[model samples]
Target chain A: MSVRHALLGLLSEGPKYGHQLRQEFEERTGDVWPLNVGQVYTTLQRLERDGLVESDDTASEGTQNVYRITGAGVDELGIWLHTPPDLTSPPRDELVIKVLVALRMPALDVRDVLQVHRRYLVELMQQWTRLKEDEGEFDFALALVVDSELFRLDSVIRWLDAVDGRLKRAEIEPPVAVPELPRLRRRLAVRR
Target chain B: MNVLELREVTKAYGEGMAQVHAIENVSLSVERGALVAIMGPSGSGKSTLLTIAGSLEEPTSGEVFIEGAPLSTMSHNEKARLRRQTLGFVFQDFNLLPGLTAAENVSLPLELDGMKAKKAHTIAMSMLGEFGLGDRASHFPDQLSGGERQRVAIARAVIGNRHLLLADEPSGALDSVNGEAVMRMILNACKQSGVAAVVVTHEAQLASWADRVVFLRDGHVVDQTVPPPTPEQLVHTAQQR
Candidate 1:
């Protein structure tokens, strides 16, 4: 669901500021859609601009900006929640795009992917151990997640080994590394 | 109506076979306009305590008051009506109807109580507006982002304006930004409307949003801290929990 609708929908229970809405969203959904705090305020600003939500005139002293959904927003949200929106084809993710390009880049990219998974598997295993100490059903869920991560990591690691053997048998030099300075710069800028 | 009350309450899940004690001698009170959080780990009996207090599921053995009267001897229908009239729930999952709009989702709780469509929708629309979903109210769940879905869920939960707000991981699916916003909004509503709230959360950051934070581990309140520590402490507590 759209964050905007979620914000407005939540306000239906009562009026709330931006920060409050973000917390409730996570609490209700089990951290399935973690929101950045800045995004919550930004979205609220947009909603207010559209007259979908209105904030109180009071000067709140917290990071949360006080806002409540507007009547128009309710009407619009009502329509959208019931009516099916025009469907767009699923967009390709970076993983798919990267994998497609990896095929022409020799087997090194495959090894890189394997490395990432191996690290992730280790992390998940660590998390699972810590979570079990807390004594909750989260352990059950984490176990499943850890299992999947390990399984994926194992598969990738195996594939990497196979690729290594094939390369050795072929006796071919590995692909030369290419500097991606521009791409790295763009990524760093985007992060900032 | 008193709705629910706990007197030095303690709840344990298993007997000698597999004893998993969920709550330990916890006392809480929920009247009208009372929203509460029973924050704890997965096995913590916060849910158990809530179910018993709400009279949805009985406590292993505790004195639960409903509507100024005792529910200890009430029938199933009596308890059901009590639940319908006094309590509303918001699950971690946004349980909105696929066919329903934002307003429709908000109106469900009231509608279930036999409120008319016109009346319910009117209230629902107002509720949606209150949360800020006005302009794109007609957009379906698919068209909405994660934050929007959560907003819809909150609206639906509060549409009935039930006195007690029992949210289980209310912001579980939201991003930190969205999650914080949701918590603030819930607390504000509870504060402004004087709805006593009990929100169950594993995140101390979220729990800090509450007026009081009673930390629970292994289904027991091991500590109670008012106000909060610095952001570091809150974060540390959350991570440790």
Candidate 2:
């Protein structure tokens, strides 16, 4: 999330050029998030401007500038590692919004809408599972990334199932109404 | 030829007004070397369809066939012999005999069908090795991990020239990692042995391993769709990128 802190942490190990930092960052994160060299260099420049890192141009010939973490950078990385991410406010989720909108629609069956999205999420999870099966066990970094994704998807699925159960218990049904347009009426009739 | 077929099959219980149809006019065919998964919510007749296909229960009406033979024409003993020789089953409970070692549990099916003990044991051992449980072959069901036990159950199901495998929530009792491992084993069995399979599961991610998925709703075949992509295809795409 914070590329600045991530670059600083990598620099804490030793002085490294932009290309080497990008490669190690990808390798450590299981290659899930790819970082371009340009982005790495930009972050380095920002870190130098903020006095968190020092760039030594004389160490390396040509255009390459080797950067190392300053004392301030070590303190920043330490604090970032110990601090927990903010989670007090719920993030805006499109699936949750879709369910809410479907509930208010007079002609739509909310259960059907839920099922459609549920299947899609399941398909996405299956793709990740396939990836995990092929390569996760051989590499610890990839395995951790895959496991984290699977758990995240599993939680969303659980939430969807819980919502479906609540709707069933409440016995809520969409209002029955004939569509004004002929084409819409025909589609609804076919679905029935 | 289709390894399993159900023609206009309907299974009902009770009588008159109280009669309930678990599956009504449902027809399905599973070809050899293909795997089909059935998905549905509770009480949707997924299990009923499986039982009827396996000849474990008689359909109230319509015909069931295995390997082109109608089940209606086979006597009880004949059906039993067919099941012993051609069909295999795995369940959520792992269904291994508590007293038998992994190798013995796997060999029991072959032994019951009149094979010599030595020959059965040899085949079972080879199958266990293929499933990566060679070292655990002498271990009892209780001694093995959940994943290992499920693999043994699967090896037992597919051993001895069995043509079809029917599984009902075979990974239900295991954690996600073990569950995925069980599914991979099942997929491997179907591909390598050319055995047809029908698996009924509540988890759609597990069901996605199948070549086709059938969705059931209130005793009806509501929908059928091919899964998104195969693991091989995904890997190939990733490599290309």
Candidate 3:
């Protein structure tokens, strides 16, 4: 799922510039992995540096730069095609991890994380809505996203209220007591 | 008679102070042509029971029988053979081959079992056509929509006439409308084919689709419904206050 290999794989099909790559990637994957135009260009630059891909920088004015997979890129793409892509080293899902950590942290700011998640869910809902409204028929990729991802987005929206309640309860709860605190503090004070 | 059964199934984790009885003395049955669901909370051991039934994992204790035969007696190859010939699975994730087209995914089991490529593709295409995805049969998994992918998985599962069709949270990934469509398709197809189904779900809506719904507590079947409700009944019950 590396943008690098995806870029190379697309280039192997034919020459494409950054915008073309971005558009093709979205259309192919059904936007399962959102790629920005900037990401496509950056990955193209890296691929060029690695010699896995080549680009003609001297394109005529008003025309986009044309990039194609190199010999090495073809070899790499072939290997990746046969092998299972390593998903273990995927980009960290900070939203999931941060909330999980917040659950562990004593009196953690659950409210803050929920607020952030709420904002993100709101933004995601807008994207899904716009996509739905703009498109008449369902493309398979978009259909999949509309079904599963929208449910996930909605679930997060619903969960924010639950998290807020949990945080409010935590804030109102009494402090924990330690039975041996006074004796332990006296022992430490003597040493100091 | 029970076509499939679980006997005093008890699964426990940890030892000494940490010992947790995940499933305790649980038993259930699935008759021929039945579509049953095992529903429970997160730590309720429904998944463990399912894995044991599917022969993917060994139970801590007790016996699992499919069509009156014991799973414990089977050797690895025997189990594999039985699974290949007699069982079909529909995972919530749809477990489709990413590179393969929908038709190819449906054809995999048949090919693996030594069916001719042309024959298998013919059969697979017919199944996809049944599910209204004939036109998209050539589309890869990534190219298909979520609902389409699930239907493809269902097609793949039932393609070979496997006796038992087991699904784990099959509709967990679908939207309400698409989920309803998948449920109807699965139930109707299984019923018509006379294939026994065991669906695992936490969602009440999906559980209702089962011919009979079984509720789990810890690891045991705590409750069971008789004369399984109709789809209309299920929906009415779901909407009840």
* Leading candidate by lDDT: 2
Q: Once model 3 is optimally superposed onto the true structure by TM-score, how far is the C-alpha of residue A18 displaced, in angstroms?
A: 66
Model 3 in CAPRI terms: which quality? incorrect
lDDT (CA) per prediction: 0.64, 0.85, 0.75
Residue A46 of model 2: what lDDT?
90
Per residue, candidate 3 scores C-alpha lDDT tens digits across B79-149 of 98878888888998999999899999999999999999999999999989989999999999999889999
What is the lDDT, from 0 to 100, of the residue B144 in candidate 1?
Answer: 79
The TM-score obtained by chain A of candidate 3 when compared with the true chain A: 0.48
Error of 2 at A186 (Å): 42
TM-score of chain A of each: 0.46, 0.83, 0.48
Error of 2 at A174 (Å): 13
- TM-score for each of the candidates: 0.50, 0.85, 0.55
- By DockQ, the best candidate is 2
- TM-score, prediction 1: 0.50
TM-score of 2: 0.85
Task: State the lDDT at B76 in candidate 3.
Answer: 97
Question: What digit string (tens of lDDT, one per residue) describes model 2 on residues B20-128?
Answer: 9999999999998888889877788999999999999999999999999999999999999988989999999999999999999999999999999999999999999
User: How well does candidate 1 score on lDDT at residue A182?
Assistant: 28
Candidate 1 vs candidate 3, lDDT winner: 3
Question: Which TM-score does chain B of candidate 2 obtain?
Answer: 0.95
